[model samples]
Target: MSLPAPETPLYNHPLPQLERWLMALGCQQDRGDRHCWLLHQGDWDAELSLDTEELVICYFPHQPQRKVVRSFKYSLSRQDVEAAVLEGP
Candidate 1:
């Protein structure tokens, strides 16, 4: 009998999966860094970074007054991260 491979956790999804997940939400990789990405919709834009322990996101890049920064643990589900990131501050 063949054994099934263990399932990967959401936070542990491969880089390609991560890229696809972000792209599906209209986000694109930053030209300068593969770990960095940007998403734009209407007048709002967000920058995201995939770090070792967390996913860091900044909403409203230039305007300090309206900007919001959030970090999510890698243990969280992909849907949780998406909801938090896509929901504007």
Candidate 2:
């Protein structure tokens, strides 16, 4: 029987590679905080945060009541994290 490889953490990704992936998805880094990023498409806007243990995403900054907050483990695939970020609220 074969075993699957262990999952890799998102934080394990090099900063440059992570930045490139975000750029490819039309997300820009927040000037105030390198750990933060902003993405806008049409009327939708979201903020992404790279915390020590989690990737936090907040969607629809204008509507605090309607904003969606999602947290993903740092130990997740880049593709998985990308999907969550791009999915929006």
Candidate 3:
């Protein structure tokens, strides 16, 4: 049997790829809005916001912060989000 050809990527594949990266790095999507997402990583957390047409990573700076009821537009890449959620300043 012959193998089928690989499918081509559509647009930018940052979300799907970022999802995988988050999962691998033990980051969970606690919650998400139309433009932003909340990620829980170990003892750290980050707020990913999508603004205009770019993804932005806004760190809480303070640790042990609880999730609040907030929503805002975001425009960021999963790669950046994953890195921010996993890494820190």
All-Cα superposition RMSD per candidate: 5.3, 5.8, 8.1
Best by lDDT: 1
The C-alpha lDDT values of all candidates are 0.77, 0.76, 0.46
Judging by lDDT, tell me the better candidate of 1 and 2.
Answer: 1
Tell how far residue 81 is off in model 1, in angstroms: 0.9
**Candidate 2: tens digits of C-alpha lDDT, residues 1-89:** 22123245576777676667677788899998999989996657988887878888888855455888999997788777777777778
Q: Flag regions of model 2 displaced more than 4 Å.
A: 1-9, 61-65
Model 1 lDDT, residue 35, Cα: 96
- The digit string of per-residue lDDT tens for model 3 on 1-89 reads 22112131211444565444444655455464655556654555566554555455555645666443332223333344344445653
The candidate maximizing TM-score is 1
lDDT of 2: 0.76
Instruction: State the lDDT of candidate 1 residue by residue for 2-88, as single tens digits.
Output: 211224345667778778777878999998898999998665688899898899988885445678889988778776777778776
Q: Flag the better candidate by lDDT, 2 or 3.
A: 2
